[model samples]
Target: MAPMGIRLSPLGLAVFCLLGLGVLYHLYSGFLAGRLALFVLGDQAERAGPGGPDAAPGSLPEGTVDLRELLAVSVLAAVKGGEEVKRVRESNALNEKAKGKTREGAEEKMTSGDVLSNRKMFYLLKDAFPSVQINTEEHIDAPDKEAISWDRSIPEDIKKIIQPKKVPAESVTVWIDPLDATQEYTEDLRQYVTTMVCVAVNGEPVIGVIHKPFSAYTVWAMVNGGSNVKARSSYNEKTPRIIVSRSHAGKVEQVARQTFGNKTVIIPAGGAGYKVLALLEVSDKKQEKADVYIHVTYIKKWDICAGNAVLKALGGHMTTLTGEEISYTGSDGNDGGLLASINVNHKALVDKLPDLEKASHK
Candidate 1:
């Protein structure tokens, strides 16, 4: 016992550290071994050709990390590299659309440089939150290109829910702007700005953001639920409010009356983004401590992705009316309809909806 006082000296400590480093190196080596093939071939290399130098046709050693996790991380990294590509496309598209909005002025278009500024806003998001990936495959592309213009002439309300993404996998989708309201931005039409971004978390938009750049705002909500429906001035339990389309004057009026009652102080504005902003402003207002906001209508994916991020950051949710999670796996990039709410728990929407459905049926 007396001899054991300092048996383990600095040499022993050094040896322990060496063993720890050795264990770490082994783990690192295993991970690298599993990913070597992926790096050379890419995610879809198996379909590239019969066999390549990098292709591994055998099993991995035991204790190796799961390939699926590696795949997810790899895909995520590649997608990030391409985010700026999306920004460039958005900039060019919006710049082209801005000319359209200018003509719509009275109406008023965003400045020629506004498109670039808007692109920067997206960059801000990427820089600020590295974890939240930007997947813009919200049906912005069209098969024939000719189909693109055709989709635009359709009713605004109708186009809002039309799916546009080419679902690449259970987790991947291609977003196409069949019609991203060029007439509004081109002609300076304030309320005409609209586009959708389909989102998927393992192929779903647990949340979405719908932006109306001309209005300089956006609408966000989770895909599986609603927000707390609180106002800026008071979190007081007042009548639920619905943010409707401003450009579609008639529909907006109808929705306002139907959802908030004839006496409801209509939160009038332009773009779906405006509607969501109104709710958020009210929620943030010191006068209120409210819990949620609600959007009751159709909106495509691109229109909601960014805003969904914001709403989610602020503790809100957006979802479909059927109590299903908002998903971007649809062939086109749109869902039939979406129901957004603030602060309201997702379960509450389910628990309370059946009774509302029954009452409506009556």
Candidate 2:
């Protein structure tokens, strides 16, 4: 035999070619499917990189940390603070002291509850996000070096709602009211007490977390990111019920009466956070439901920023008496008087209001 020669018929060659083509098509289809899956998942590549999801909390440089992570940290801090509030209240050791006088000449007080909660919340956030600016209601010189423990996990529902993005530390600000309604807390009005945290990006509140220590309830929202609480479907626009501060009710009641008529039901409550929750209709008690929240005279940003973010997330608006959006960057005080509403025409309500100053005089 000279040399064995291998030969294939035309049909055999065609079959071989078809088999090769099928293999290539399968490989190509698999590659394309993977790319499509990554695209739909949103920022999966970013999360896999440094300072991403795999990185430990506080391991990344300031501002490089993911916003979703920051939001989760803030939620943890708020709940931790709420726990402190409840602990101190149950101990019956408020040790309340007068902090100073409010702009309206009312005595502003601080207590052990405020200090402990503030320390807990501030350190928790600062440890997780070292460079982000944090503004807390209480001022304490001591550092909490007790090795705070918190679960860095974000809730699946929350993660589903918030998109992935990294915000620079310089552009982010965290406001913490460790113990809102301390006065009410001292008065045994535990329902009004709340621990709140707000994350403002570029001077606008984008994330809000409010926790009621007494009831162990928490409601949070991130702008464009979803809220745990649902907005009220119905609003009483005509003769609308309004929620005002029980502590600062005089001026707001007068203004609300002048604007919405004397028949307007003015529900007096404590704490800005509580009043805002009422606007969202997330009240434990039925009487706390209201159409709008009105405040006259000065208010602090920490007192209302969380509420503002919550309102904005729900497609509502919170602004000045003259319908101006409040800025959270520079001064902490809002002197324009506060007007917040959901489900109703906020502008229409603002337009009806008389001058706050003139109304106060009357």
Candidate 3:
């Protein structure tokens, strides 16, 4: 150390100073490069520096509970947007003479709540969490659309079981249904209207939220974060109550009737989301709860993702009629049909699918 301090000539000293500065700069840049952060405000989002990992496509940190809370707020805004439409529809501002006459007239009849909510939800998500991959039933055509990165905050237990080898090299993707049960919403079946948001990590539904604007009830769940409302099954009775679609019952009613017989009461409700919730909802008058939810028709992933998440979180089951689990990031259409119930043993209903097919063919 004494020799190093005393032995430098002019040229050597100059070279050493330059080298030291170079090393310091390299260290500083290395430390600060990836730590750049973003700050967002109402309609004003700003980036402090340009070196976030999100700058790289399909790379993001794991999501956390904060993301779930953000998702909940975003979904609630969608529900509020739908409420706005319902409010206007009930206000009598539009003349009753032109209800459901033409395509434009029909759109005007419902007040564009679905599209409006879809737009708001997609845009708000973009502004707040810029790195998430988003898929929606309604396509948004914003020019500056950018998919950002997300540092997923997965549950520890789930993360342990999910092999790192199985996770795809992509950011988390969220599927959104701004408004579920459009037909029921238009028909003023307010109870059936729901806004849904689902987050799929590695093609799995890890987080889901179902919001009902009319009832001001919201249910959400994560892999480890249980639902706000715990699901209680009313399945002890010999005869179980079942729910089917009011608009698209299809072979479900026929197969259900064949399997459960006349003693089983099949409650017809609108919206797959609403039907799922009915399993938990106690009837106002009769105080009865649904025991099973069956839908043996083609449905979309967005329609069932939130409900499925809620049901699974409540220790219930939601799967294809063929006893297959619904894949969130797979095909948009669920072709095999769906069967969901809380507290009821799934094996009984799952075993009946073959008999249902046989009976339907007859």
Candidate 4:
């Protein structure tokens, strides 16, 4: 009974297109820069820093990894992340129902829809995707970060390293383990938070979806550009044309304005997927630079998923700060900074970009 694919109205389609190719997926699934997909799965990827599966192959003393083991670890990570957010969501709901609009808490609060969406998220991840599976251990001590799930799309070698529990994914191949920043979500913020999974066999994704267990809506897509299960988002559109971080607003806002002009509009703060999607929104205007996603910081796999799929489907591209092609099943982006270039040429950006380390850090 949940919607089965990505659906968009003419207006929604235009909004999605402006968001990013990832936001418009169904054409193809990819990871996003911030995802421009809707929300970032890497709600707290920055906290995880760069280790575990994210480690460069050669950087490891072994210079190799077992896929199964990697999957297990990632699954563990995803589960912890999920649980933490769940707790936050429920607590926020209870607190809000008591306060009833006279609340002063700045945390974005959940709506009735978020509660229902949690059920749907477990359904798709557990039942829909054919190539992915989820295993939850109640007593499992989640890491400091939280939200954990296993991924098997990686090659056998990586699987061998992780020693993951091999199981059949649902009809959809992608497994999105979304953890929208609970802090932001509970604050009743306009931007959504989520992580997504997109399965591309021979370079085509038949599956795409986003799960927002903390908001009134859970937006996702499947097959082709059908906006199934649309999540509630910013309709008020004070339209300042600015981008703020759900978790790190002050820092990201400072740097974002440095790149985008001071006059840029500010979208309500949300997760990376939301940010990526927000970046896409700017493209609707005439500034070609809106398409360009500049990474002065780091990123991760959970951060990219559905966003990546949406953009690639629409002929857009995401790269590293170095302008290297980003790999989803290959590496976690936080290790290498990310850069998204819309219709514009990013090679020029890479060529001209000053070292943030030298300039910003200075």
Models 1 onward score TM values of 0.40, 0.83, 0.66, 0.44
Q: Per-residue lDDT for 166-279 in model 1, tens only?
A: 122334332322224334444445454444333345654433444443333334333334322322443322455444434433433454356546764434334443344554
RMSD of each: 16.2, 7.1, 11.4, 25.2
lDDT values, one for every candidate: 0.40, 0.84, 0.63, 0.42
Q: Write the per-residue lDDT of candidate 4 for residues 1-362, one digit (tens) a residue.
A: 97799767999988767778655574455544446534543644443334344543322222233223333333333343444455655565424332122122344444332333343344434432323433221112224222323343444433432222222223213334445443455564523555344443323433333444334333333333333222222322111344444333444455546655576444445565655554443322211223344444554454565555545544455666566665544333345555654455557656655453233232
Which candidate has the highest lDDT of all? 2
The superposed Cα distance between candidate 4 and the true structure at residue 231, in angstroms, equals 18
Better of 3 and 4 by lDDT: 3
lDDT per residue as tens, model 3, 192-266: 777888877766676677777676666666665655566663474346677887744555666566666768787
Pairwise lDDT winner, candidates 1 and 2: 2
Off by over 4 Å in 1: 1-183, 187-199, 206-237, 247-260, 281-298, 345-362
lDDT of 2: 0.84
The runs of at least 3 residues in candidate 2 whose Cα sits more than 4 Å from the true structure, single-residue gaps closed, are 1-62, 143-146, 149-151, 357-362
Worst 10-residue lDDT window for candidate 1 reads 144-153
Give Cα distance to truth, residue 204, candidate 3, Å. 1.6
lDDT of 2 at 94: 91
Model 1 residue 220 CA deviation (Å) reads 10
Estimate the lDDT of model 4: 0.42
